[model samples]
Target: MEIVLLEDVKALGKKGQIVKVNDGYARNFILPKKLGVEATSKNLNDLKLQKANAAKVAAEQLAAAKELAEQIEKVSVTLKMKAGEGGKAFGSISSKEIAAAAADQLKLDIDKKKLVLPEPIKTFGNHEVPVKLHKDVIAKLTVKVTEA
Candidate 1:
């Protein structure tokens, strides 16, 4: 029997996949458990429409991310931190702080999780930070850390 999987089966195939299984297995386990449905013409058409819609939405998101990346690249964020002797910073700046600064200074609402800092900002100077806006989009932001 040919079946369209509604959900993943560990040994067989993932959701949205078409797989051929024995008649007894499809009737007893797959159909009864609602893990898959018979590969009817209507069901196949519905899957095709769903996949097209998903692809369209994904493309829109990628375009939006690219636009945001352009804006982000032009803006610079300034962060103030407490410093001790010899111009050393007391504590390092975090992604949350950077996101807050970007929001407050540039009016950009960036998520802290998207800011990728290899190491915390411990020095009082200018630095470039990479912000991942999307899977394929990365924006480089200039951050200036000054003594408060």
Candidate 2:
């Protein structure tokens, strides 16, 4: 029997995949558990439609990510911190603070998790930070740290 997987089945196939299985297995296990449905003509048409819709949505998301990356590249976030003796920063700046500063300075609501801070900002100077807006899009942002 040919079945279209509604959800992933370990060792069998992934979701939206068409696999051939034994009649007993399809009727007893797959159908009854709702893990898959028999691949009828109507079911195959539905799968085709679903795949087309998914592609469209994915393309839209990629375009939006690219646009955000461009805007992020043009932005420069300034962060103020207190410096102690010998011009040493009291506390290092983190991704959370960068996100907050971006929101305040540029009016961009960026998620902290998307900001890549390989090391904490510990000195007062200009630094370039990488922002991951999407899987394929990365933007360099200028961050200026100054004494408060």
Best candidate, TM-score-wise?
Answer: 2
Give lDDT per model, in order. 0.94, 0.93
lDDT of 1: 0.94
Tell me each candidate's TM-score.
0.93, 0.94
lDDT of 1 at 29: 97
User: 55-132 in candidate 2: lDDT tens per residue?
Assistant: 999999889999998998887999999999988898999999999999999999999899889888999999999989
TM-score of 1: 0.93
lDDT of 1 by residue, 1-148 (tens): 9999999999999989999999999999999999999999999999898889999999999999999999999989999999999878999999999999999999999999999997899988899999999999999999999999
